[model samples]
Target: MRLRDHVVVVTGASGGIGRATAEAFAREGCAVVLAARREEALEATARECGKHRGARTLVVPTDTTDAEAVEHLARRAVEEFGGIHVWVNNAAVNAFGRFEDVPLEDFRRVLDVNVMGYVHGARAALRVMREQGRGTLIDVSSVVGAVTQPYSHPYGMSKHAVQALGSSLRQQLYVEGVKGIHVCTVMPATIDTPHFQNAANFTGRKVVAMPPVYSPERVARAVVKLVRHPRREVVVGPAGRALVRQSRTAPAVAERVMARQTEKTHLSRKEEAPATHGAVHVPIAGEGSVHGGWGGRRRTGMRRAAVAAALAGAAVAAGRRTGRGAPGC
Candidate 1:
């Protein structure tokens, strides 16, 4: 689809994939509406968007957890721009801890933003889209949504909910014969984002992005592609695709490898971290960006990630060889 003059709304525009996606739409000459809790960070994103020729952005400071605020965000986008051609429900938060150890409030907070935030955005955007007779709703889910992870209990659950949200919405739209409204989900693997550093960490160990971390721009490219040709779901990175495929074919091996990975590489073994609610209840101001800069010996780390990936691959290969997962390859 030609998207040069499309109007796009992107939540969580303060940083990470959301910021990258917003900038991408701006580059496409789309009127981008930036929404997040941090006004300063939103302004920063707006400035970056404005750098592109024909890029116009509106900074709407919105806490996606707030239903009313999200509604206002959609209205603002419609008011400033002509209409909402695409809405990116990308706002999210994470809490790192065992299912029981993590505080109940933090868990709920994660759901409020990650799941319910999409609910609000979908409702508001769909209302406008139904009226306009065309629009796209993009939900940013995770690879963990397809394959579960340890310690990030709430995060995994919330992403699973996001995946469900998109599916259910699409089915309902079909039932209602809503021809022009489209709901799509984007599942990205670990990327170079600040989510790891800002998560509510209670594991007493520093959280890391592990390895095989692609740049946020990679995910941005995926989102932009979706705008051109909407799909039911899109997995961004090769590792993410492998994990999803492994989980489907060799479920047992996928679970074992994922548990081992989250237990080992996902958290720092030597560095001690204090228990704190990182960004669950508050926003990190003046420090938001597209990249997290949480780098280790990435080449070595990726070698380790490659090993884990090979394990998953080997399991699938073994399953095919043994005729366990399927009749044949």
Candidate 2:
């Protein structure tokens, strides 16, 4: 589990959480293999990683939706690094729209990239791990995986599948007596990443990273920790952890709250957006970085606190109106 000279393969390493995760492993002295559809951006990420610890990196231009390409990616990583110690399935895409409003093609593309992509990574990584008898596979899922949102059904469903995938993998590995191999899932809240900017949209309104947006680097750190001490799952953001707990205890209330919150917060009421497939079928070309220009980490905690207080006040006000409690309550 030591990171020194550890061989880690990170998919979706072009930007966002994947980029941050790769950098984190690099800083730990791991030899990093970066995979994404964009080769130039992967190179950019590799350069950034090399700046830390002069980490060794290999850039693999991979389209995760293509099973053959993903298999080749695994092969190339092993060839360069000798073996895979950790494989992080971080490649994913989103399409924001009402279920029926989303083009069937776009929805299918999202599913293929998000769900089948992980499947391919898991299959390839496990093939090598089973031979070596030790490895950790990390899947970057989302809070929406546990709690569904109004729009972005394909994304939510795909993430939910990721959650199940990890769980099923762990259970099977345990019973099968597969020692030293672990499957871990990390579910993060809304993260400040180019994910929103690159998402396909058909909602007629611009997509926004809802408030309480945690930095993608935060999720990256959680991933690094999981590599040290693997767990079945971990929710990265405070808001995300709370929402998952709420969904587990009060499913109906969580669903209703998510429906209302997503409508009010996830889409810009003022900004208009024309339908376009963003990075679903084709990769977006640009210099990519870890942050999405969202504000710093200090603001995230403040916003989460403010939102929680407002929601609590609203509940109290409704209670008084319904004559169910004292006026103060």
Which ranges in model 2 have alpha carbons more than 4 Å from their true place? 296-298, 301-329
Write candidate 1's Cα lDDT for 185-292 as tens digits: 999988888999999999999999977787788799899898788999999877889999999999999999999999989999999899989889899868489989
**Tens-digit per-residue lDDT, 1-329, candidate 2:** 56887899999999999999999999998999999999999999999999987589999999988889989998998899899999999999999999899999999999999999999999999999998999999999999999999889999999999999999999999999998999999999989899999999999999998877898878999999998898889999888899999999999999998999899999999999999899889999976888887763767767778999999999999877788555564
TM-score of each: 0.89, 0.91
Query: lDDT (CA) for every model shown?
Result: 0.90, 0.92
Clashes of each: 0, 0
Alpha-carbon runs more than 4 Å astray in model 1? 295-329
How big is the positional error of residue 270 in model 2, measured in Å on the Cα after superposition? 1.2
C-alpha RMSD between model 2 and the true structure: 6.3
The prediction achieving the highest TM-score against the true structure is 2
